[model samples]
Each structure stands twice: as structure tokens, then as C-alpha cells.
Target: MFSKSSNETKIAVLEERLTSYEIMIKKIDEAIQIMGKTSQTISKMLAVHEEKLDNTHKNDELIIDRIKTMESKNTEEHHRVIERFEFIDSKINDRIEILDKKVDEVTKFRWLILGGVMIISFIFSQSSMVVDILTPDTDNVRIEKPR
Candidate 1:
């Protein structure tokens, strides 16, 4: 009877240990499942980020191309404006030259007219003096009136 009782106690202790080990294995399985879910979530996030990066890169290229095109167009427009300004300046210079020539001609004509007037005045004044000297003195001379 003593040996039978000891064997029964040993069996009960082994059964308890087996139950604990089974519980521990169940917890370990749950932890593994959680880790797999976390890995999947991380992978999905990484894929999304990569896609966004690609789109951003494409957009940057497009923006750079547009800027280059605008710069070329601006350069062309600048050249056209410069050419137009130069043409206008040349035209103005030509007009100014023509005006200067006309002013010079007018000045010369004015001087010629003034010199002619002075010469004519001098001639008239000398002629009067000569006439007075050639005529006899009216104070000592007698004059007769004819009917």
C-alpha cells in the first residue's frame, strides 16, 4: 500500500508540470503571431513611402523642365526687346541730326539777312551826306519860284 501511494503522487506531479508546459507553448505561439502581424504592417508602410518618393522625383523632373523652358523663352523675349529699343534709338538719332541741320541753315539765313540790312543802311546814309556837300549853301543863295 505504501508503494502504491508514492506512485500516485509522482504521477500527479508530472501531470501538473505537463499542463504548465502546454500553457507556455500556447503563449509562445501567440507571441509569434503578433510578431508576424507587425512585420506585415511595416512592409506595407515601406511600400507606400517608396511610391510617394517615386512620384516626388517625377514631379521634380517636370518642374525643372518647365523652368528651363521658361528661361529660354525669357531670353528670347529679352533679345527682341533690346533689338526694338536699339531700332527706336537709331531712328531718334536720325531725326535729331536732321533737326540740327535745319537749325544751322536757319541761323545762317538770319545772319545773311542782318548783314544785308546793315549794308543797305550804310549806303543810304552816305548818299545823303554826299547830296548835302554837292548842293550850294541854301542860307547865302537866292532862289526864284516860277508860276
Candidate 2:
């Protein structure tokens, strides 16, 4: 009977140790589940951040392209304006040359008419001087008779 009692006490001790091991296993399973949920949440957040960064990069590229296009257009317009100004300057110079030629022609015509008038007046004056020199005094004989 003493041997039987000792054997039963050993069996009870084994059963309590088994129950403690089961409780520890349950706690470990709960910890593993929490860790899995946290990993999934972190992965989702990272994906969203990556998508936003990609969109921002694309928008920056688009803006840069548009700015380059506008600059090219502005440069083209500036070239056109410069060309127009050069054309106008050339036209003004041509008009000035034409005006100078016209002025020279007018001066020549004036000198020619003035020279013709001076020559005609000189010829008329010479004729009158010759007539006065050739005319004789006809009243001398009548005066002697009266005396």
C-alpha cells in the first residue's frame, strides 16, 4: 500500500506540468498572430507612400517639359521681332537715299534757270549801250540860224 500511494502522487505531478506547457503554447500563438497583423499593416502603408512618390515625380517631369516648350516659343517670337525691326531700318535708309537724290536734282534745275536769265539780261543791256553811242545830235544847225 505504501508503494501504491507514492506512484499515484507522481502521476498527479506529471498532469500539472502538462497543463502549464499547454498555457505557454497558447500565449505564444497569440503573440505570433499579433506580429503577422502588424507586418501586413506596415506593407500597405509602404505601398501607398511609393505610389504617391511616383505620381509626384511624373508631375514634375510634365511641368519641366511645358516650361521648355514655352521658352522655345518665346525665343522664336523674339527672333521674328528682331527680323522685322531690321527690315524697317533698311526701308528707312532707302527712303533717305531717294530724298537726297531728289534734292540734288532740284538744285541743278534751279541753277540752270538762273544762268539762262542772267545771260539774257546781259545781252539786252549791251544792245541799249550801243544804240546810245550810235545816235547823233541833230539840233545844232537850227540853233546857229536862230543866232
TM-score for each predicted model, relative to the true structure: 0.71, 0.52
Q: How many pairs collide in each candidate, listed in order?
A: 0, 0
Local distance difference test, per candidate? 0.92, 0.87
Evaluate residue 26 in candidate 1 and report its C-alpha lDDT on the 0 to 100 scale.
Answer: 92
lDDT of 2 by residue, 19-134 (tens): 88889888988888888888888889899999999999999999999999999999999999999999998999999999999999999999999999999777766896756766
**Which candidate number has the best lDDT?**
1
> Which portions of model 1 show Cα errors greater than 4 Å?
1-14, 129-147
| lDDT by residue for model 1 (70-102), tens | 999999999999999999999999999999999
